[model samples]
Structures are given as C-alpha cells and as structure tokens.
Target: MIYLDNAATSLKKPQGVIDAVVSAIQHSGNAGRGSSETALQASRTIFQARQALNQLINGHDPRQIVFTHNATESLNTVIKGIFNKGDHVISTVMEHNSVLRPLYELEEKGVELTLLSINDTGTIDPEAVNNAIQANTKGMVITHASNVTGDINPIKKISHLLHQHQLLCIVDASQTIGSIPIDVRDLDVDILCFTGHKGLLGPQGTGGIYIRPGISIQPLKSGGTGIDTFSHHQPIDYPSRLEAGTLNSHGIAGLYAGVSYLLDFGVDKIRDYERELLNFFYQELITIPSIKIYGHFDSNVDRCAILSINIGNIDSAIIVEELIDRAEIITRGGGHCAPLMHEALGTREQGVVRFSLSHYTSKEDLLTAVKCLKDIPKDLN
Candidate 1:
C-alpha cells in the first residue's frame, strides 16, 4: 500500500532503525539494571538514544530528557504534575485531546483554563495569548502544529511573551519535532513533548519529554527506576524523577538510529523535500472545485507535511476506503485526535480525509493520489 499516514506514525522508517531495534533485542539485555556485558550494551543503546535526542533538539543535557510511552503520556505527566488546584493555564483550541483532556480535568479541580480561539486558518495569534495571561497564570501549553490542519503556530513569539510574564511554556511537538527544526534553548520551552514514531521515524511506543532546568514535576508513575534503589523515595533528578520505570530499550534503540539517519541527511533537507511535495499537492488539489482543503495553504507558513481535505458529497470514511481499496493508497480519516481543531475548521461531522506525506513520498505517489481524487465522483449519493 502507498501509505500517506506519516502524521499518525511514519510507515517507512529509515533502514537503520529496523536493524538497530532487531540488533538490540538479539544482542543486548535489560538496560541500566545490571552490569553484565549484555546489560552494558543495552545501557549504551539507551545512552545513545538520549544523546541523539539531545542533538536533534539542541537540548542542554541528555539526562534531562525522559523517555515515555508516547507524546500523550508525556503531555499528561507535565500537565497533571506541573499545574495544581487554583493555578491558571492557557491553551489553544487547536490542541489535540492529549493536551485538552488533562487541562479539562484540571479545570474541574478549580484550575482556571483559557482556550484561546484560533482563526479559520488554524493560526493562533500570539498577541491574544499575551492578553489572556492573568496574575495566577502559571503556564501556557500549546501544540507546535495542528494535527488536523497542519497549521504551524508561532511558538517563538508565544515563548517570548510567556517568558515576559514569568510563566512556563509547554509545547507538544508531536507533529513538528523531526519534520521541523526545534531548539529547546532557543524556544525557551519548559517542557517539550514529542513522539518518536511520527516525525522521528522510530517504532511505536517510543517518545520523550525534555524538561528544562528549574522546573520540578511529580512523577506520573512511581516504581523501580534503577537509581535510588536503597531509598523508598524516588530520585530527585531531572529524568529519574519523572522516569520511574524500565526503559523501552528496543524502541529507543530504533529511535537513536532514526535520529542518526535524520542527522546525516539534515533536518533542513528533509523539510525542504517535504515542502515541495506539500506545495505540489496543495496547488494541484485546489484546482478541483469539489474539494475543500484545510490548513494554511501558503507554503510560507513553514507548516508540517500534513493536508486535511474533503471531497464534496463524499464521506471521509468512504474516501479513505476508496483510496485504500481502489488506489492501493493508505490515508487517515476522522478527527485525528484533534477534535478541537476539526471543530474549529468546521469538519467535526465528517472529519477530514488526511494525506500526510513524508520525505520518502515521491512525485509519482502524489500524482497517483491526485489522479484518484480527481476521478472520484463528486456526487456520492
């Protein structure tokens, strides 16, 4: 199948990723729990993953990054741990359920929440965010890019404004981490959540959070963290404090390889290639009057390679099925876990047929998708 679901989880991983994961499972033992040769190898793999992550994001220290099951978990850990009752927070309507749900739960507990509205183009105004801050506002959480609309947010501007207010900034970079360039130091983000499988091209169950120094968070799950075994209390370190369970050595090994591949190719190169594909798709799809495309159509937006659209009179599910069954093309449909974004875009009822591209997607694949979309009957009754 010609997979177009990179935003969900990249299907075509770098060759090194698969090899590294398999090699780790075959040769290495449990990491950080023992001193055996196999265990040492596993520990090295985990270390390399952290190192790769640091290099990818320009993080301060590798140890400050904590591996989690996925971006959702990382977001929840930060949202629930950092904000207490009576604290106020700011988020955008473009946020996925991952960020929205935690903040919603906090709202019930008297944590004031302000969901800033976005324009129809899915762009959040940084000035509006600055206006929303109050005396009790402790943090501002925002997604780097809309999972549904692929609209890139002005994170740097938001960061600057939030810093001026002495409020923490938490960014969910699930859609933008590997696809776009990000420097944690440059962004001044307190907590950054990212998924490995989406942009990083790693296996599923691999993701992480980068916690800036001076930000303390309670652990989501307290358990054996290899360190502080003698003491009953969890270690009060950057990663160890938040990471309270055995690491996902195999997935992390794959993530390291994927990141290494990106490093060698350069993130700019990947982004440029993907932008070419997105621009081509956008230009071509707009010619069809029956199709309604979402997101910032301008290529200058520096957006992700995700496109959300719908053909007139065709249900999104049926379009997805046709793409898969008739064209041998795979794409995603429905809200994409960003119901707020879909609602904002007026696509909640039918959702949107999403064709998310990757660096691996070729001109031929785009042509094939375009041909299929053009051929589909506009009247689906």
Candidate 2:
C-alpha cells in the first residue's frame, strides 16, 4: 500500500530503529532500577537517546529533555506545568487537539485563552500576537506548523517578539521537529514539545519536551525518580523533577537510532526531497476541475510534505476509505483531530482528505495516487 498517512504516525521506520528496539527488549532492563548489566544497559540507552534528541534540536542541555509516552503527554506536561489560574495565554486556531484539549481544560481551571485567527492560507500574523499581549498575559503557546495546512510558522520571528516583552514562548513541534531544522536556542523557544513517531522516524510511544534555563514548572506527576528516594517532594532537578516512573527505555533505544539516522542523512536533504515530491503530486492535483485544495501550494515555502483536498462535496471519510479499499492508498481524513483548523477552513462538515508524504514515498506511487484522486470526481458521479 502507498502509505500517505505519515502525519498521524510514520508507518515506515528505518531498519536501524527496528533493530534498536529489538535489541533493547532482548538485553536491556529497567533503566536506573538496578545495578545489573541489563539495568545499566537500559540506563545508558535512555541517556544516549536524550543526547541524540538534544543534538537533533540543538537544545541547551540534554538533561532538560523530558521523555513521555507521546506528544500529547509531553504537551500536557508543559501546559499543566507552567500556566495557572487567571494567566492569559495566546494560541492559534491551527493547533491540533493535543494542544487544544489541554488548553481547554486549563480554561476550565481559570486560565484565560485568546485564540488568534489565521488567514485562509493558514498563515498567522506575528503582529497580532504582539497586539494581544496584556498585563496578565503570561506568554504564548504556538504550533510550529499547521498539521492540516502544512504551513510553517515564522517561529524565530515570533520568538524574538515574545522575548522582547519577556514573555514565555512554548512551541508544539509535533509536526515540524524532524522535518524542520529546529534549534531550540536559535528559535529562542522557551518550551518545545515533539513526538518521535512522526518526522523523527521512531517508534510510537516516544516523545519529549525541552525547557530552557531559568524556567521552572510544576511537575505533572510525582513518583520515584530512581534517585533521592528520601526526598518527600519530587526531585528539584531538570528531568528527574518532571519524569515520574521508569522511562520508556526500549522505545528510547529506537528513538536514539532513528534520530542518529536523521543526522547521518541530514535534515536538509530529507526536507528538500519531500517538498519536491509534494510539488510533483500537487501539480497533478491542481488540474482536477472538481478538486478544491486547501492551504497554499507553494513549493518555495517551507512546509511539511502534506496536502489536503476535497472532490466536490463528497464526504472526505468516504474518499479516504475508497482510496484504501479500491486504490490501496493509505491516507487520513475527517477533521484531522484539528477541529479549530477545520472550522477555520469551513470544512468542519465535509472534512478534507489529507496526504502526508514521507521521504520513503516514491514518484511512481505518487503518480498512481494522483491519478486515483483525479478519477475521484468521476467516481462520485
């Protein structure tokens, strides 16, 4: 099957990633739980994974990389950890549910939320963010890229703006981390959350967050941190303060390998190739008379290798299912777990079929998929 649903989770992982996980399960034990060889191996694996992630994002300290089950958990840790009652926070309508649900819950607990509107093309004005700042405004939490529109935000510019005002800058980098050349220090992002399963090319259940220096947040949970058992409160340290139980050592082993592969191949090469493939597919899509594509299709723009479209008024889920059944094309449909973005596009009801391309996607496969979608208008009738 032609796998185009990579935005959800990259179904195609490198052989190194698979091999690392298998090795970890075979030889590694609970990290930091014992003095045995297996336990030591597990501990080393987690440490190395943290190091890889640190280099991947050019973070300040490897110690600040807090691993979690997924981006949702990582985002939750940051959202619940930092904000408090009556704190005014700025966000955007292009956020995925991972950021939305947590912010909504915080709103119930008294955090004020101001969602900034984006243009029809999914681009937000950096000036609007500056205009929204108030006395009580604690900071801004923004997505590095729109999962629906594949639009890259000017985070470096926005981060500079927020820092000028001494406000916090939290970035949800779930869709951009591995695909985009993101350096925590260069971007000046105070808190950045990401998932390893997507662009990282790692296994599922692996994600993390980065918190910059001179910043503190409440722990989302408290438990044994493999050190200082005598302390009553969570350890006042970088990762130990946020990490509550045994880490996902095996998954981290895979993540370590996955990120290393990315480094070896180079993120720039991967990004450019994927963008070329997206342009190739889009060239075919734009010619379809009945197709209405969402978001701007600019090859020069640095966006994710993703495209969303609809043929006539057909239900997107139906199109997605048909592609899987008849065309053997794997894709994502519906609101894409991004209701606010769907509402913004006026596709909340009809939804839109999404094609999240990957580095592994082939030209032949893309042509076949485009041909199938081109015939969709005929099939609908």
Candidate 3:
C-alpha cells in the first residue's frame, strides 16, 4: 500500500528509532523513582531526549522542555493552565480541534476568545491578529502551519507584534517541528507545543512543550513526581512542575534516535525532498478539470508537504474508498478537524481528501496516487 497520510503520523520510522525503543524496553526502568541501574538508565534516556529536542528547536535550556503524551496534551497543558477568567486570547480558524476545543471551554468560563478568519489564499494575515487585540487580550495561541492546507503562518512577524504589546505568544508546532526549522529564540514564542509522531518520526506517545523562561503555567495534572511524594501540590520546579507520574521512557528513547537522525540527515534536505513529491503530485493531479485543490501553491513559497483536493462535489470518503479498493493508496479524507477552515473554504459538507507527504513518501508513490485520482471518476461510474 502507498501511504500518504503522514500528517497524521509517520508510519515509517528510522531504523535507529526502532532499535532504541527495543533497547529501552529491555533495560530501562522508572525514571526518577529509584537509584537502581535500570532506573538510572531510564532517567538518562529521558534527559538525552530532552537535550536533543532542545537543540532541534534551538531552545534556551533543556530543562524547559516538558514531556507530554502528545501535542494535544502539550497544547492542553498550556491553554488550560495559562489563562484565567476575564483574560482575552486570540487564535485563528486554521487551528486543530486540540487548540479550538480547549479555547472554547475557556470561553464558556468567561475568557474572551477572538478567532481570526483566514484570507482568500487560505492563510492567516498577521495584521488581522494585530487588529484583534483588545484591552483584556493577554496573548495569542496559533499554529505555525495549518494541518489541512499546509500553509504556513507568519509566526515571527506575529511574535514581533506581540512583543510590542507585551502579549504572550504560544505556538502549536505539531505540523512544522521536524519538517521545518524552528528557533524558539528567533520566533520569541513564549510556549511551543509539538508531537513526536508526525514530523519528528517518533513513537505516537512521545511529544513535548518548550516554555520560555519566567513564564509559569499552572499544572494541568498533579500526582507523584517521585521527589515530592509527601507534598500535597505538584513540585514547583521546571519539569517536575509540569511533569507528573512515570514518563514513557521507551517512546522517549525512540524520539531521541529520531531527532538524532534528523540532525545527521538535516531537516532542510528532508523538506526539499518532500516538497518535490508534493509538487510532482500536484502538477499531475491538477490536469483534470474536475479536481479542485486547496491552499496556496506558489512554487516560490515554502510550506509543508500537504495537498488537499476534492472531485466535483463528491463526498471525500467515497473518493478515499475508491483509492483504497482500486489502488490500495492510503490518504485521509473528510473534515481535517479544522471546522472553521472548512467553513471558510465553503467545503463544510464535502470535506477535502488530504495527502500529506514525508521524506519516506517516494516519487513513485506520487505517480501511483495521481493515476488513481485521474481514473477515479471513470471507475466510480
């Protein structure tokens, strides 16, 4: 089967990642829980993973990197913990449900929310964000890139504007983290949340958050942090403050290997390869007049390797089913979890079929997918 749903998760991981997880499962124990050799091994693996991720994002310190189950958990920890009632926050229509649901929950509890809409090019304008700021506006929560459209937002520009107003900037980097280069210092983001399973090529349970120094977020969860078992409240330290209970050390070990592979191979090289595949597929698929593609596709622009399209008012699921049955090509269809983006694109009812590529996605895979799409309407009839 030709897999093209990498935006959801990386099905093909590096060999080093597989080896690391196996070794960790065999030898590692609970981190920070004891002084045994196995426990120490677990602690060291987690620390190495933290350092690798910190370097990947050019973070200030490794301790600021807090481990969570996935990007959704990291986003929830920041969103639910940072704001209080009466505080205003700004976001965009391109957000995933992970960002939107928590913000909606906060809005119901009296936090003011202003969700900025996307422009004709299916991208958010930073100036719109600047205009949305109110007297009570404390910060903006935004994605570095849209999951559905794969269009990148002007985060650095938005962050610069936020700095002028002294408002905090929180970025969801789930789509951009490993495929795109990110420097926390350059963006001046107060918090950055990411998942390991997508662009990072790590295990699904592995992900983290990077908090800029001096910003304190309330703990979304509280329990045994190994060192402060007697304390009623969670520890006030950097990682222990946010991290509670035993971490997924095996998955984190794999994540370290994944980051190491990216470092050695270089993220820029991988991005260029994936973009080649995306453009190749796009050029071929757009020849058919019945197909309508989404997102900005200027060759000069740099965006994630994602393409979403629809065929002549057909339901996205039906097209996906045909691809699966006829050619065994796997792609994601239906709503991509960004409800506002679908509404803006006038495709709320007919969700787009999303084809997300990774370095693992080959030129041959794109060829097969293009052929399948071109013949779909004929086969459906």
Candidate 1 structure lDDT: 0.89
Runs in model 3 lying further than 4 Å from the true structure: none
Residue range 1-381, candidate 1, lDDT tens digits: 788999999999888999999998899888778899999998898888899899999998999899998999999999999999989999998998999999999999999999988965678898899889999999899999988878888888899999998999999999998899899989888889999999999999999999887789988889887777899888899778887778888989999999999898888998999999999988999988789988777867699999889998577999999888777999999888887777777787998999999999998898899988887855354
TM-score of 1: 0.98
The Cα RMSD in angstroms, rounded to one decimal, for candidate 2 relative to the true structure is 0.9
Question: Which candidate achieves the best lDDT against the true structure?
Answer: 3
lDDT of 2 by residue, 344-366 (tens): 99999999999999899999998
The global C-alpha lDDT for each of the candidates, from Candidate 1 onward, is 0.89, 0.90, 0.92
Q: List the residue pairs that clash in candidate 2.
A: none
lDDT of 3 at 310: 95
All candidates: TM-score? 0.98, 0.98, 0.98
Question: Residue 113 in candidate 2 has what lDDT?
Answer: 94
TM-score-wise, the better of 1 and 2 is: 2
Question: Weakest 10 consecutive residues, lDDT, candidate 3?
Answer: 372-381
Tell me each candidate's RMSD, in Å, in order.
Answer: 1.2, 0.9, 0.9
